[model samples]
Structures are given as C-alpha cells and as structure tokens.
Target: MRLRSLEGRLTLLLALAALTGALVYIGVTEWPLPQAFAWMQEAMGRHASVFQPSRVDIFVICALVLLPLCWWLGHIVMDPVKRLLRALESAVASYRDGDFSISIALNRRDELGDLIHMHNELGQTLREQRQNLAQRELLLDTVVQNTPVALVLTDAGDRVAYANIAARHLFNEGRTLNGLHFATLIADAPEALRKAIEGTEDALFSVEMDGSEETFHLSQRAFRLQGRPHRLQLFRRMTRELSRQEVAAWKRVIRVVSHELNNSLAPISSLAHSGAELARRGDVQRLPGVFATIGERARHLHGFIDGYARFAKLPAPRIAAIEWKPFLDALALHCRFQLQGNAPSQPGWFDPVQIEQVLINLIKNAHESGSAPEGVTLGLNVVGHELRIEVADRGPGMSEAVLAQALLPFYSTKRSGTGLGLALAREISEAHGGRIALANREDGGLRVTLVLPQSATAS
Candidate 1:
C-alpha cells in the first residue's frame, strides 16, 4: 500500500514497532549487557534483600522501554483517524437535524477523503434543492395572498388552517383567521352567504355590505391533505364582470335592432318609390300588387318589433302545480313532437303558459334544424329536486363556436331567425331560479335542457 493511505500508515507503524524491538534486543543482548549488569549490581548493593537480580532482568528492562514507545507510535498513527471520525459523526448528526449546511472539511489521501467528498456533494445538492423549494413556496404564497379571490382552507376538524390576505380582509376584517372554527367564522355572515358556504354545492349569492350589494361566486372542493380530509372554499367577486356583460348585451341589442330595421325598411322604401313612378305612368293594375307587397313587408316588420317587445317585457312566472300529461297534450297542439316516454305522474310546479311557450319555441327550432319531422322529440322527468324538460333533435349538431353563443340574444343561424327564442327560454328559466343547458348528443343532434327546481318560486 502507499504510505499516505490509512492501510499503508498502519502497516508502516507495525513494521517500525517490530524494527525497534529488534534493535532493542540487539543492543541489550549483544552490545551493552555485561556493562549494564555491573552498573545494576552496584546500584542495588544497598538494597540487596529487595533487589535480587537475575539473567532475565534485561528482558524486563526492554519491555519497560518498548511498551511506552509502542503506545506513543500508535497514538501518532491514530490521531488523524480519530479526528476524522469525530468530524463525520458531527456532520451526520447535523444532517439528521435537517441542517445540510454542515460539512466536513477534513482532507485525507485515502478512503476517508472520498467519503468526505461524497458527503459534501450530498449536502450541496440538498441545500440547492431546499433553496429552490423555499423559493417556489414564496412565489405561490405571494400569488395566493394578492389574488382578488378569497380562499380558505379548513382541516378535517372543520377548523381554519389557512386563509389568504383577501380571505382575511373579507371575512375577518383583516384579522387572522387561522385556528378559528369554520362555522364560527361565518356565523355573522349574510344569510345567503352562510347558506352557500355551509352547503355542499357551489353557488352564487349577493350580499349587501357597506351599503352596496356585492356579488360573489362561491366554489368548494374536498380533498385529502397529508392523508387527512380537508376542504377548500374560494369566493370570487363577480359584480364587475356581470356589470360589464350587461353593458355589452345592451350594445349588441341596439346594434341588432338597427341592422334589422334597416334591412326591412330599405326595401320597403324602394318599393314605395317604384309604386309612385308607376302611378305617374298610369299603371293602375300594378298598383294593387305593389300595395300588397308593401303590406306583407309591414306585417313582417311589425312582428319583428313585437317579438323584442315581448322578450323585454316578460312578466315574472306565476308558479302553480300542473300535471305533465295535460301540459304536454296542450303543447302538442302548437308544435308536433314525439314524446320520448310517459309523462311523470307527479305534478310539476311552474307557470303552464310560459312553460308551454318555451316548449313550443324549442320544438319549432328542432323541426327547422334540418332533421326529419319524426326525429324531433321531447322529454320530461323529475331528477332529484329539479324538473328537467329536454328537447332533442336528430339533426347535425352545432359546432363548438356556435354552441357557446347560441343562448345569447340576437344570435341565430337562420337567415330570418329573430334569435329571441332560446334567449327568452333562458330568461324564463332563470326567473324561476333555474337554468338551461345545451349539449350535443352522441348520435348527432342537439339537446336543450331546461332545468327548474320542483319547489321553486319566482325570484
């Protein structure tokens, strides 16, 4: 082995010890034995009874010198090893305590040196990883704290575990919300807000706060955190978004109305001019046809105006218990549809007249959707606490782009479509505290669903 290595050093020490013993033996037995014995006899002459010298005295003397010499040599060889072991032990303890900054700086030209180098690299890697993790956590905290949405995280015990800055400001007036019971935190909240938070479903509710009404959309999720159940609630302010949408809706309405009026009136004006020119030329027979054409356009324009007026002036629904069989029978008179199944035996709560109108408009749309007349179908059923009225057609379904804006007023696919049919249905459904959903069927069709609460009243 190389002399600088640990194994080499131990071998060198053993060789040196053996050599020293050999030299001591040669000097005592061969070079100075007779002289040493004469000196020892003179010094022991005064204590002759206690000092009985023998031929083996040289061996005892050699042992006395060699034992201390061997001990000193062993200490010289093991001191570095002992110190390195101490350093390694300390560094491992520090690592166990989550302190990766501790590193052994001892250098050796052996296996211990390689161990130290590997240990330092591990520490460096751990330190870098910890730093990156801490930075990511800080960035995430910054975003959560500054977001406009209020966020609350509660533990399995229903106690608040985390609340962001917005959540604190919203619920506790800038006070910390950690460790508070979730129910107690919302105890003083508005009835609508309390009900929305306590319920298992997501909801949108308005609260009168600081003399103005603020609307919020509440969403909740349940998940496992560290193998324990937790719930997260997010409240997003939607008042400004809703206000912007309302303004844009009014602008679209005005634009659509102007375009429609010009389309109808321009042709009517040109026809009138033609009729007057013919009169000047003494064309009396053509005058009646011109007037008849003008009447038809006028009637179409009147009907166009009346549809918008009715949509804008829709009354609140007058809810009443009505049987599905009679209502469906009455709706069949206005629009032909194949009822998919037997009507519910249970009576539904809704305004029969308004619902009948909604079904008629839907069935009419299905009939005009390029489907065979027999392919248009209507379905009614009660699901949970809601009543679902579905109108489906086996026609080519709409594209993603069209489906997104289909429920908006003045959005239509047809050349003569007023676009108020689906929009009016949506408005009526919402007025009864319900909603409408549009989906595409798997077999190539569109499904329009009007969902109303079975026990809902006008809202």
Candidate 2:
C-alpha cells in the first residue's frame, strides 16, 4: 500500500509497532539471555547464574520497551493532524474578526491537506466579496459627498448622524456636523429657514446672507435605518432657478403687449392719416367714414386694455350658498351648452358672481373651439366635499406642447385670443381654495374641469 495516504501511513505504523513488540517478547522470554548471564557470572568469579530474570520481570521489560516505541510511532503518524487543528482554530478566529486575507498552505497527500485547500478557497472567496463591498461603499460615498443638494440624516434623538459636504457648509461653515443637535445647529439661522425646518411639512424659504437673498426648497423624510428610526432632510437652492423663470415670464409679457399695441396703433395711425388727408382735400363725404372707422378702432383698443385691467385687479370672492337651478338657468342665458348631468341639490358655497364669470369664459371657449353647439357639454357634480364642474367639447384636442403652457397667462392658440380666459379662470379657482385640470377625451376633444371646495369662503 502507498504510505502517502493518511490511512495507509497509520496502518503501517500500527503494524510495525505490533511486530516489534512480538520480537521483543520472544527475545526476553525464550532467548539464551539466562545462559549469557551465567557466562557473565563465571567471568566475574560467580559459581551460579544469580542474575536470571523471572517471568514477571521479562513481562515488565517487554511492556516498558513496547509502550515507548508505540508512543513514538503514534507521534510520528498524528503530529500533522494536531498541527492542522491548531491552524484551523487560528483561521476561524481571524475570520470572526473580519480578516479574510489569511490562507493555509500544506503539502500532503491526505485528508488534512484537502481540508486546508478548501479553507484556502473559502478565504479567497471571502476576500473577493469584502473587496467588492468596499468598492461599492466607496462609490456611494463619493456620490453622496459631491451632490449639490444639502443632505442631513438625524437619529431618533434628533442629533445629526450624517451630513454631506454641502450640508456642512450650509449649517456650520464647512465643519463636520456629526453628533450635533439639529435644533441647536440651526439656532443662528434665519427665522424663515428655522420655521421651515421645524415645521411638519415641506416648504420653500428665503434667507438673506451678505445682502443677497437665497431661496431654498426643503424636503424631509422619516424612515428606519440600521434598525433605528432616522430622518433625512434635503435642501436644494432655487434662487437662480426662480430668477431665470421670472425673467422668462417678463419677456413673454413684454412680447405679447408689444405685439398687441403695434397691431392697434399701426391701424389707428393709418386711419388718422387718411382722415386728415381727406379733410385737407375737402372730401367731407369720405372724411366722416374715415373718422367713424378710427372711432371703432379706438374702442376696440380700449376694450382690450380694459380686459388686462380687470384681470390685474380682480376683487376677492364674496362667498354665499348658491342654488343650482337658478345658477344654471342664468348661465344658459349667457352661453350655449347642453347640461350633461343633474346638478347636486347640495348648496355650493362660493362667490356666485365670480363663479358665473369663470363658467361663462369656459363655455365661451368651448363654443369657440369649433364644436357644434350640441356637442359642447357642461357637467356639474358634487364629489365628497367638493363641487366639480366640467366643460367638454367635441373638437380637436390640444397638442402636448400647447397643453403644457395653455394655463399660463397670455398663452393662446387663437389668432385674436387675449389668452387670459383660462388664466383668469385658474386664478379664481385657486382663490376659492380649488384647482383646475385640463385633459383630452379618450375618443376626441378636450375637457376642462374646475374643482372647488364646497366649504369655500372669502379669503
């Protein structure tokens, strides 16, 4: 048998031990040891073999020699196993301490060697996993650290657990914010910012620093992290964004007003010149017609200017309980629309004059949309604590691009449209604690819905 294997080496060592023990027993019990002792005694001037060993003495001698020999052979056979156990114990301890770099290498054609190889493979796998985890953590930290939005994470006790670079600069002049009380950190902050942070809702607040005002949007979220409740707050600067939007809105207004004024003034200018020329030529018959035309143009321009004035100075709504039948009947007298559903018997609380004006504009827009008079529909329904009024028409729906800006002031698709119809309606809706929504019908056409709370009051 090959002695390279653990089983083979152990069996060989045991057999060799047995064989040696048997030989020693025979020599001590049956060999010529007693005769040799007697010759030694004659040489030493003794008459008899006085040193002859007994059966028990021979047995003791054999036992002593065999025990030591067997022990030595066992040590040779099992020393590697004992050493392998110690190494494994040490490796396990290292792994428990999160050190996966340690590996064991041993050369042997035995079970112990196979075990060592497996242990090395496990260590390699663990090391690779730890390295990958570290890389992911590094990437995540880099992204969080460099983001422009200020981020702060607070533990359940309201102490700062983590803060990004932007947050540090914002609250503490770029100093680390770990373990600081959140309330105390903002103690020196502006009142608006402090209120926004302490409030239970997301908000936009402005802070003036060194003679410049900066606007910021604050968003907060609460959730569990690492088995403990934590809150995350994000602050995004919006000063430049708001400024850009304000500039764009002013440009749009200027463009629209200039175009309208040019259109009116150019015609009026030409008419005034024609009238003067006719008067100078003593063409009295044509002068009167020219003067009449000029008057009409002036009136049209006056009415256009008046529309903007009313939009800018709209009065607050005087809320009152409104009965549906009388309101719808009055509305029908002003515009053409087919009532789609029965109006709720529940009294609606809003300014009747303002609401009537809003509905008139909506119905007027519906008719102007090129839908047949019968195809224009007005619907009213009470849903929970709100009043919903929908105006739908069987006309071409607005494109996505137009729909996005349709509610904006001075935005229109019509050639002569003032563009204040929908904008005015939206302003009134919000003033009454309501909102407006526009959407396309599934089959065709567009639908505009005005939602107002039933309990609306003057504000």
Candidate 3:
C-alpha cells in the first residue's frame, strides 16, 4: 500500500525517472537556439549558440533525489521482514514443544502469506500425527492389559517394572509387582520356565502353588522401551484345557463300558429266566443249550473287558535287535491267516513282542474285512530310511466322518467290536517312534500304513 512491495517500488522508480527526463528537456529547450549556435561557432572561430542540458548535471540531481527515497523504501521493506522472522521464531518454539495450535492471522497477499499458510498446514499435520500415535498406543495398552496371558515386564537390571492383571494373580496372590526382582517372583521355578525367560526355548510345565500344581505354557521376548532394553515373560495357563479333555475322555469311556455291559447282561438275564421256566414245565431238553448260551456270552463279555484293560495298560517297549524276516515268519506260523511280504534283509531295532502284537492286530482287521482270503495283502518296504509296514484290505473303506474318529479310543465301525485292537496297535507303534495312518485306496479298499522312524528300526 505504501510502495513497499516489488510491484509498487518498481513503478515508483520508473515514474520518477521519466519526470526527471522531462524537466531536463524543458529547461534545455527554453535556454535558446541562438546561444547554442553561438557557442558552436565560437569553438570553430565563429559566434553560434546551441542549447542542450549536459547529461552529467541531470544525472547528479537524479542520484541525490533517489538516494533518500531508496533509504526510506529500505526501511519499509525490512520492517515487514523482521516481523515475519519473529513470527517464525514463535511458531518454531511452539512446534518444538509439540504444541501445534497456532495460526498466523495476517492476510497480506504476498510470499509471506504463502509461508504462513504452509506453517498452518504443518501444524495441522503434526496434530493429526500425534493423535494417530496416541490412538495406537491406547489400543495396544488395552489389549495387553486385558489379555488372559500373564505378562511380566522387567528392566535391564532384572527388576520387575510392570505386570498385567493375570501376572499379578499368578505370582504372589495379586500383590504389587513393582520394585521386586524378577528372580524373587520366579524363585525356584521349573527348568523349562527358566529356559523360557532366558529366550532360549519355550515349554509347557507345572509349578507347585498353594500346595497344588498348576501348569503354564511359557514364552519370552526382548524389546526396547524409552531407549532401554526390557524383557517380557508370558505365562498361559493350561489347566483348564487339560481338565476339559480329561472330562470328555472319561465320558466316552463310561458310555462305552455301560453299552458293552448292557449287551452281555441283558441276554444272560433273559436266558436264566427261560431256563428256569423250562425246568418248571419239565421241558429240560433246551435247558442245557440255554446254559451253554449263557456261558458263551459271559466269556465274550470277559474277553471284551480284557481287551480294553490290555490297551490301557500297555507297557513301554524294550527295544532289541532282531532279524525282520525271521520275526515275520514266526508271526505267520501262529497267525490265523496266511501272511505275505518279503521283509528287508537288514537287521532292525525294536521291541519284537510289541511289533508282533501290532502286526497281529492289523492282520486280524484285514482278515475280518471280507470273505475272500485274497482280499488282504501284507507289504513291507524301506522308503527314505523309514520302515513301512502296510496292510491293505479289499473291503468297503471308511467314510470321511468315520475315518476322522477311527483312531479315538472306544470308537469302532463294527457292531460287535470292542475297539481295542487298532488302538493297542497305535500305542505300540508310537512307543517305537512310529505312527500309523489310514486311507481309502482308489480301487475300493482301506489301507493302513505304519511308518517307523529309521532310528527305531535301523541297525
């Protein structure tokens, strides 16, 4: 407004220069043509004067006039620059302290206006960034505090710094966790737990608490907080999961036992009453057959119960070195059906008794699958240092649902089965560092494969 800007100052200087040139032209023109011609003639030995203002005098007067104006204009321009610098300093200080609630109120339409707008934008951006950071921290804190997993945080000196709700309850009956040494909290802890805290390994182990035992799955990690190293310990309780599984297993066992006992007891009771009536009517001819039927059922019940006992009480295998061919031959000699398969020529390490028991069960399942003797096949081979013993049967294979639960204890497809044979086979195979899998062959049959680790069989 006061000719203190680029556009105003340029215009002012141009107008002043034009005004000075006009004044000099008028003054010189008014002086006299005759005087100017005389001066020229005198210089050539003749009297003539021609009038023109000398360039030096005009330039000197212009310099004197512009100097004071330039000095005044500099003050006008520099005053605004100094004020802008002060405003910038204040904004910078506010931003340094993480406060961005400021806006330059000036409305000048210049480069300074753009700078003020940029500062406002920067302030808004910084405020948004701070809000985002705070929200993320809040979310993370909520999750960590509310989680069921016990979390204990320790400083670089192994002193406990913080603990969540679960950790407080686990370590000293909900006492304060601050200022306590980490070692004191976990005094005489289990080896597995110690290893977990040291970042060496993870484990599931039990610790004595309140005169009873409690199981915990342990994990650990290291991190930096406020530029200092910290460690975190996580303990997840496993007692609830284990108790649930145990209760479910007991329910299954009771149901199966009740069903098998009922099957035998009902028929035996009916036969006893019928035999009594036959004797009273003097029709003793069927009495002996009734007694015989009762005996058979009782014996069947006994055998069924015995099978379950054997499966539950199977002992650990006593590994021994033996020839695979001779062992299979001995089993075949005593088997109900003909056995087939050329065993590997090498000697193997395993419990001969346990391996034989597993094979006997598989063979029995195969033989009972169908009426054809050729429906069953025995196969033995070494695949990638694994000893595979597979028994395939040409009977109807299991459906998806049935196969899923086939390995469960007391679960069976056959109506008369006790469901112990395959379970016992699985227990023995696993004891020898082996596992069994069941699959339906494409050609319409079920194939059970036993895969034993090389270390369990190789000699």
Candidate 4:
C-alpha cells in the first residue's frame, strides 16, 4: 500500500513499531542459541562449581544485541513503502493541478503499476476529447456567423434558444434577440411558429412579414440533441426567386393577350386602309386588287396570331423513351427543305418533333438576321451527358440592350418581327428540364445553344 501526508506517516510509524515489538518477543522467547550455549558451558565446567550470571545482566545483554537487528529489519520494511507513498503523493498533486504528465515509477511488475498506466491512458483520452470539442465548436461558430441565410434554433416548447448574427439583424434590426420569444421577433412570427410547433408534418413554407414586403422561406425540422427536442428554423430570402417567377408568368400572359388582340386589329386595319385607297383612286376596276391585298394581309396576321397562341398554350410534354438516332433522322427529313444543300459535319441526336420545332425557329431567326455569303452554321455535339445543339451566325450579334430584353414577350429587335420565337424555344426547353442560352460567338456572330440531357442507353 502507498501512503501520503502526516496521517499516512503516523500510520506507517505505528505499523513499524508493532512489527519491532513482535520481532523482539520472538528473538527473546524462541531463540535456540541460548539452549545450545548452556549445554556447551555445562560440559566445560563439569568437574568445577561455576558462577551463575544474574537475570538482569542476561536481559541487558540480550536487549543490546537485538536492538541493531530490529533497527535493520525496520529500515528494510519502511524504506520501499516510504518511496511508494512519496510517488503517489506527487501523482495526486499533479492530477489536482490538471497536469497529466506526472507518472508513477514502477520498479516491479505489480497491480499498482497497472492502475497507474490505466489512469494515464484515461487522462490522454480526456485531453484529446477536449481538443476535438474545441475544434468542432470553432467550426460551428464560423458557419453560424458567416452564413448569408438566417438561422434560428428553438427549444422543444418553441422558445428561442439561439439566433445567429444574420437572424438577429433580420428580425431585431441590430437589437438583442436573446431570450426573446420566437413569436414576438417576427412580424407574422406567431402563426409561422405555431404551424411549426403544433404540426407534426415536416414541410417548407414561405412567410411574408407584415408591414414590410420581405419574404422568407422557412423550413422546419425536429431533431433530438442530448435526448431533448430541438427545432431548427432555416430562413432563406425568396424575394428574388418569386419576382423572377412573377415576371415570367406576366410575360406569358402578355404574349397570349397580344396575339389575340393583333389577330383582330391587323385584319380590320388592313381592310379599312384598302377601302379608303379604293375610294381615293376612284378606280372601280382596281377595287378587286385592293380587296385581295386586304385578304392576304389578314391571312398573314391570322397566321402570326396562331403561332403566338400555340406558344402561349403549349401543352405539358408527354415524355416517352425514344431512340435518339432515329429521332434525329426524322428531324433532318422534316427540315430537309430548310437545310437545302447544307449538311452538318457530325450526326445530330435529339427528339424528332420537339427538336425540329426548336431548330426551325432558330434557323428562321438566323435567316432573318443576315443574308448569304455569311450564312448561319448549325452545329450539334454530345459533350459528357448533355447534347448541345448550337445555331451560330456570321451576322452581327445582338446589342447589349436587345440581348437583355431578347427573351421578354413582345420585345423585338427586328422591324417586322413578332419576337416570340426565342421565347417559345426557351419555354419549351425549360419545360423539358433544359435551358437555352444566347451569347456572342468569338468570330463576330450570335451563338444560341440548346443544352439538353442525354437519355441513357438501355443494356
């Protein structure tokens, strides 16, 4: 056993004293040397009467001889125990001061050494855990502070527990938000928080703050932290996304309404002009020709209206698995008249009817943009998992102003154009989970690329 402090020292001293007493009694009462010496003395003094030693003298001599032997035995027993006690005391002192470097010195293979080894191992583990926790906390703080989106954490009762800097600025306007109720911080927060807390369903919802036109998309999720329920409210600004969607919807509406109005107005305007010209000329014989011109313009205007109507009322695609090679072949056959003598260097791959319409619109736009000798180049390629179909023209690309409003309905750069072809193509591509992008080609031309996902080949 190990010992420490004054109490341990006293106990060790008492134990040593008891051991000394027992050793002294065994030496005096059970020594075989006294019997053997007495027998030798009797034999030597057999013919003469010898003097006998007193009991007191014998006791003193025995005491003097055994004293040193007892001291040596005590030293032998106490020395190792004292060293072990001192080592234990030092170890305990270091542990109390939070220093784990101190270790017990073991001179022999024993249980005490095994215990010290295990204690050191546990200390190492605790130190490592502390470091890891510190790092994780630092990382979490960085994310919470630097993220653009507002983050709020709530307890099981729907009380606000933590709010990040962004969230605080958003709800409290640089004021303190800690300990504030979740309902009080948000303008329409009560209903939103109630929906998250009372409802068991997990969902994403948008909430617009009252008095302010700010919209926030809120996603509620319930989870357990340390066996306690925690609800996280992740807020994202939806003003831009919603605005873009609204603009697109408005464009669609305008395209449909404009087409309908133009259909009626164009025919009426042409007929009225023709009738006035016939009366001014005073030529009854030319009246039929004027009427014919009116009819032709009216038919042309009807065709334009029909095109716009088709774009506005485009039906949802009935998606089907199709062989890309055969589809492209059919598209080429359908557009053979437009292609004339031009053939692509590489084979094209796409859906036939849908892609043909896209190609026709693009080619028609290209034809209107410029004349021959600087003709349009239609290119198709499969890059990675996307099929890129590009219609590039050698004519001057669109100006910045026109480029900006190119896809908007009723926005046209050409004098005699309806400006619905590119918009229709964009709508179709978006419906198919694809995109169409316009850019100026490097060689002073316009490049329109239609990017579509490639269907997987069946095994």
Which candidate wins on TM-score? 2
> In model 4, which range of ten residues has the least summed lDDT?
336-345
Candidate 4 Cα outliers beyond 4 Å, as residue runs: 1-270, 273-284, 323-351, 371-375, 457-459
lDDT of 4 by residue, 277-320 (tens): 87898867877876787677678767877887888798875555
- What TM-score does each of the candidates earn? 0.60, 0.67, 0.56, 0.46
Candidate 2 lDDT, 232-342, residue by residue in tens:
999999999999989987888788778888888898899999888888898888887778888887898888889888999999989888888999889889999999978
Q: Name the 10 consecutive residues with the lowest summed lDDT in model 1.
A: 46-55
Write the residue-wise lDDT of candidate 3 on 382-439 in tens digits. 7776788888888888899988888877778888776677887788888887899999
| Residue-level lDDT tens digits of model 1 in 1-459 | 776788887888889899989888877776676566667877779455444335597688789879999999989987877988898889889989988898888877787788889989999999999999999999999999999999999998999999999999999999999999989888888999999998998999999989999999999999999999999999999999999989998888887788788888998999999999999999989999988988988998899999999999999999999977777778878989998897776789998889889989999999888889989998888888888899999989899999999999988888888889999999999998899989999988999999999873311
Off by over 4 Å in 1: 1-139, 152-162, 167-240, 279-282, 456-459
How many clashes show up per model? 0, 0, 12, 0
Among residues 3 or more apart in sequence or in different chains, the pairs in candidate 2 whose N, CA or C atoms overlap within 3 Å are none
lDDT, model 1, position 88: 80
Candidate 3 lDDT (Cα, 0 to 1): 0.79
